[model samples]
Target: METTPFFIFLFIHLSCLVLGFGSVMVTDLYGLMWIRDRVRFTQVISVSGVTEKFIWAGWIGMVAAGIPLIILKGEIDNLMTIKLFFVALIAINGIILHFLHKKVGKYKKGEHVPNLFMFRLMLSLFVSQLSWWGALLIGFLHRHVTTIINWPDMPWLVSGLILGAFLMIWGLGEIYFKVKEV
Candidate 1:
């Protein structure tokens, strides 16, 4: 096995992960502060706007690097499939978040934002975080654990996550609306 190419792509992949996840974490933190009334909504929007570039840069880089990594690895196992699933979900969620940000950006700091829109925004954020974390975890397990322990097949793992994410999204929306009502 020619490890040089694999190691190069791995480094690139890890770098992109750090950039994307770090930017996302910052954006989510800002959003949390806004939701808690500790920061102005405008500030959150501003931060998100700025961080979006870095996020996309990292995303694009990851895809670019991932192709070579996959090729070098010479096979996609169940775990790799799970990681790919999460990557796809993250890409789709990012598109939704882009539009949601555009819609939400119109409101002033103290102005009313519709419950539906707010819920969607929260949902998008949740999806983004979940997908990123899922991909990261799957990647780690694929690299480090699959050989050491027997793992469930792709459908089982993915289905379980889908169910869990669905429930969490519903609960998060309920909590967001209830907090707003208070």
Candidate 2:
């Protein structure tokens, strides 16, 4: 079969997904380290601000490209379904992270909230990273599963399922933490 435009678009979309997720992970890890007093908060904040901006740009690119790519392809199989689900999850997490970043700014500026609220926000960030990472993994693997899988081994499909389970756990833990905080 000829390589389709959809494949090109998918490649770009995946590239954005990787960049966005990787940026978030780096920022979150840096923030965590700073929180633990192992690094300078100022450094973490600076890096996070830069990375977050890049992530947002990448996300916008992905959405802009993905719409046409999905429509053009017009084939929603199991892998596509799995990819879309995780993409939605990543978008949701991005929204939550936007607000969480705002809260973190406010906190930095001496806006005090209940400790519970802070804890909830922290948990949200954690879950956001987890979901973002999981989604990227699913999206990447879904493209390769069937073609590479043996009749019994089913390597890629099995990994995708595992990733999906991890995504669910991440989302549930986020909700649980938020509720407990409140």
Candidate 3:
């Protein structure tokens, strides 16, 4: 067995996956602390700069490897395109979260992190989770599930699935944020 460029890219991409998921999980945990424990939230976030940096690194690596991996893998079909769409969603959500975190970082120690703001943050997190995990699953199953989607109706089906996931996950996130305690 010989290691090829494709294999190297795949490994880089998958390795980034683990790092990315870990960062996302830790970020969500900090968000939960923001909801449940203000004191701990500040302390944890203050020291979490390194983890946040690691996430950016992983995200960049994944995106960098993904383009070549796609080309190396050959012609993309509907499912692959949809998976790419989810990857775009993940990147978009990440940008949103970046700005939101900037706003959050400006928060003074004694001041409250507003519900509306936190709700927005939670919604962003939900989007991140949905897209990251969705894209990962779709990538893993893409070859196996390629036959399932009808090519002619692919756009509609992909759109519907993305919309449904967004709405369902965002709704659940909103509920959690709403009922969360200080």
Residues 92-153, model 2: lDDT tens digits = 76677677666666555334555555565676676566556655665556455542212224
* Candidate 3 worst ten-residue window by lDDT: 143-152
Candidate 1 C-alpha lDDT tens digits along 47-91: 999999899999999999999988877777766666677788788
TM-score of every model versus the real structure: 0.83, 0.66, 0.76
Residue 122, model 2: lDDT of 72
After superposing all C-alphas onto the true structure, candidate 3 shows an RMSD in angstroms of 4.9
Model 1, poorest ten-residue lDDT window? 147-156
Q: Could you give candidate 3's per-residue lDDT for residues 1-182 as a string of tens digits?
A: 12499779989998998888788888777767766866465665664555677777888899899889877766676766777777777777778887887787788877988776777876787888888887787777854555244343576576577777777876876777677754
Q: Please report the candidate that would top TM-score against the real structure.
A: 1
Pairs with backbone N, CA or C atoms under 3 Å apart (clashes), candidate 2: none
Cα displacement (angstroms), candidate 2, residue 13, comes to: 1.8
Instruction: Work out how many backbone clashes candidate 2 has.
Output: 0
Please list all clashing residue pairs in model 3, or write none if there are none. none
